[model samples]
Target: MTTDAPVSAEQQRREEELVERVLRSFDGCADPRLATVMRSLTRHLHAFLREVRLTEQEWEAAIAFLTAAGHITDDRRQEFILLSDVLGASMQTIAINNEAVGSATEATVFGPFFVEDSPEISIGGDIANGATGQPCWVEGTVTDTTGRPVPGARIEVWEADDDGFYDVQYDDGRTAARAHLFSDAEGRYALWGITPTPYPIPADGPVGGLLEAVGRSPLRAAHLHFMVTAPRCRRLVTHIFVRGDDLLDRDSVFGVKESLVKDFVTQPAGTPTPDGRVVDGSWSRARFDIVLATEEEQR
Candidate 1:
């Protein structure tokens, strides 16, 4: 490896001048917050370049990588989101915006697979509308931080199948393994899904190449997604991970939290399900009681 020479005093002075000029260009921004963000972003970006002593070839390579990512993105696949997730940017942003408030459930990254207007299922209904996996029984209660039940809260849930592929990843135009349901009068809800299994983020794109180059794995922990909302409560987008999942500590998206890990108790075949449903094989069950902060508390 060739050694990089230390930046000389004159070169450092010139670099600082360039950064100041770039910052000054944003002075006329009418939005005060926007101006501040732009200035700070410019400073950090310039500092990073200076620290790395980035070469022209490396900058060109970065541009090409971004171009490839853009080319591979589509309505079904989001390369940029995968890139952000692998880089820990998505989790970092979530942490910054979702400070812990009382005992409200912690928030995590919103993976790119979420789709709007998912079919709604009734309480105790099955969400696995044909996707393959071991059956899972999910039950939970929605409550405010004060322990009052929050009935009628909408809970949207989704996850990859046992094969580690979301329905959207297929070209069949079918929806499965995802649905939304509302809490009952008692703020309780239950549904049937599949046990989550560890899966790698899409590994055929620029982001995947970057991870490999940096000696990183793209595997996310086994988990199920949830987005809960109510009239007077802060919206929650989070996941409950399998407690014993081997990949929990090394989730590709860095979305795991101690509070979000839960046990998926295994039930042998012939065991009666909560709703009197029958299963031909073993299944799992989990409970995730959620508490939401009020809108005012979120502020």
Candidate 2:
């Protein structure tokens, strides 16, 4: 019998053969791209397990957790994104395909909050849907490197209310703190919404169990999500984090970028402001600029 050192030469050959067998099943597959991806994933996954000497019980536990993750996924939410986020895989994938922007704003994770077919709104329209929460006004401009306005750019923004919960989580049968807006004749916009609050990613499923096992906290700092796109410009899908937030550095998904952080300045009462902007008492403002890349889309 071979000692439990690493693996016998025969065992190594068997492992390689097992990987080959799995790849061979993809023969005559319609989607060649998917086949290639499956092959790569299988090869790397098998090799990693072997290299790490994953125990049988650990492998079973992983499988059980994955089964639970799939069971939790349904029509309303995506538990897989939550799993990937907690494992930092989602951010790593985004980083690999992240756009390069010297003068433009960079792209980040398109978290699982956005839904399909949001109502189109005007530049200064309030997206809070009149939900009860603190008043926050976010304003920004969409322009290129030459300071030219990128008119007609669509800006999609969403975030959780002050209670640190998305409307989808509340079963309210409505979309809260979400809106899709197109820039007017100019590249300016002022969005009004509820003040954001730090929220824990879906932690009731297998993902939460994984976090517990790793001794990691799953708190994501408060931030507003935005997805901006324009013809001939790089599409941005990211978040603008509140500067000085306590959980900024400890984002469970590792999605915080220093460039994306901005100060939420408090405007004193009765200050001169734009129409439909700040009114009587104290208000807050966040100014952000999204830079679009000419060479958009990952190849």
Candidate 3:
């Protein structure tokens, strides 16, 4: 192991001048927001480099890592989002954009697994769609903060199967364990899904290597994804974590909120499901009442 040489006063001054030059380069940006973001990013990036006394070798290594991340990203996977999630950047952005509004459900990181045009299911329909896992019954209601029901809200739900694999990972063009459904006239929604199990974020790529180098676990807690939208309300993208999941305190994405943890009551064999559906063995049930902030309230 080699030690870094002490930084000289002249070297520090030159570094500062270089940072200012980079920031000034963005002054001509037509977009005010873009200009501001670039200036701040330059300042912080330079500061970090100075604080760490980053070496040329380290910089080269960082570039190589980013190149690997880019190489692996495709329509089915997003390595950059995984990088953001593990670094807490995604959660921070979510917190900034999703300020609490009088008991409105809190937002969390929108994991990269989400897809468009998920098959639509009706109330009490099974989203599992042949995905392998124990059956789960999910019931919920959507309402505005004032306690009034918001009928016709669209709810999109998805989760990994028991083996910690989403349908998208299979490459078979199959759509399972994900679906969209509309809330009924009473603003109530119910569906059948598999019990969510703890799973690691994709670990076969550069993000996984970074986590390993930093001694971090890639495991996310058991939870179900939900994106709800209704007329004149702020869209809510969130998750309901299983109450007793051990990983709740250390979700890899840092997405858990205490209010979003809910009990998933277990039912042994012979217990009757709410909709008179039959299960071969044990199953579970969970209820999540979601409240959304109106657009005006969100503002």
The 0-to-1 C-alpha lDDT of every candidate, in the order given, reads 0.94, 0.80, 0.94
Compose the digit string of candidate 1's lDDT tens values, residues 111-203.
999999999999999889999999999998999999999999999999999999999989899899999999999999999999999999999
lDDT tens readout by residue for model 2, 1-299: 22246677998899889888988988878998998898889889988887877888888998898899899999877889888887789888877777455676766678877877777777778888856566678888888866788888899988888777777778758877888998767788778876667888878888888898889888898889999888987678889988888998889888898889988887788766566464657767778876666544344
Off by over 4 Å in 1: 1-4
Better of 1 and 3 by TM-score: 1
TM-score, candidate number 2 = 0.88
Q: Which 10 successive residues of model 2 have the least lDDT summed?
A: 290-299
Report residue 12 deviation for candidate 1 (angstroms). Answer: 0.9
- Specify the highest-TM-score model's number: 1
Give the per-residue lDDT of model 3 (tens digit) for 44-106.
998988888878999999999999999999998999999999999999999999999998999
Per-residue lDDT value at 204 in model 2: 84
Off by over 4 Å in 3: 1-6
TM-score of each: 0.98, 0.88, 0.97
Q: Can you give the lDDT of residue 82 in candidate 1?
A: 92
